[model samples]
Target: MTDSLDPVVAKFVDALNSGDRQAFYALLTDDATMSDDGNDRDLRQWTESEVFGSDGRMDVESVSDGGRSLVANYTNSRWGSMRTAWRFTVSGDRISRFETGQA
Candidate 1:
């Protein structure tokens, strides 16, 4: 069956696509963490400031959730197209922790 996290994942993707930094940040916990492949950096707080910045564009291709995880298909001018997964640890309707990886 489809997981319940699908809508949340979709909203996250939509925020990215619309360049809504506030909306994107609102979906994450203050201490939430995100990592990519073997990159030894935490992409939580700086994602909006550094990655999206003020002009980056994102196009969401799809979204899927597997209860505890969320995968998003998207394309961007800076990062190109990729299918990435964000594993989430939810706490009281907020994502307390998250990790990103190729899907």
Candidate 2:
């Protein structure tokens, strides 16, 4: 919550806002699966979608599941901005799956 970096998901929200590509990539598993809406996409592909623009920013509202999930207000060029929820499934230190939709 509050975009604090105590949990992996918080770190992710921080990385996304900071546009730290390496930091963002570091949070994902090698074979990570990320999907937006209902279409499956890889991390890099997903970032290219808009919510990850170099200047894209986010305001995390809450985090749950011990940092494995989060809901935040996202700003982007394409979608403008909206409240969104993201859920991540992590195995050890890597995120194996990440999915997002309307919050």
Q: For residues 13-55, write the lDDT of model 1, one tens digit per residue.
A: 5676678878877887887676667464666444654357644
TM-score winner: 2
* Overall local distance difference test of candidate 1: 0.60
Q: Which structure among the candidates has the greatest lDDT? A: 2
Over 4 Å off, model 1: 1-7, 38-40, 44-46, 49-51, 54-66
Q: In terms of TM-score, how similar is model 2 to the real structure?
A: 0.84
What TM value does model 1 have?
A: 0.64
Query: What is candidate 2's CA lDDT for residue 92?
Result: 77
Off by over 4 Å in 2: 3-6
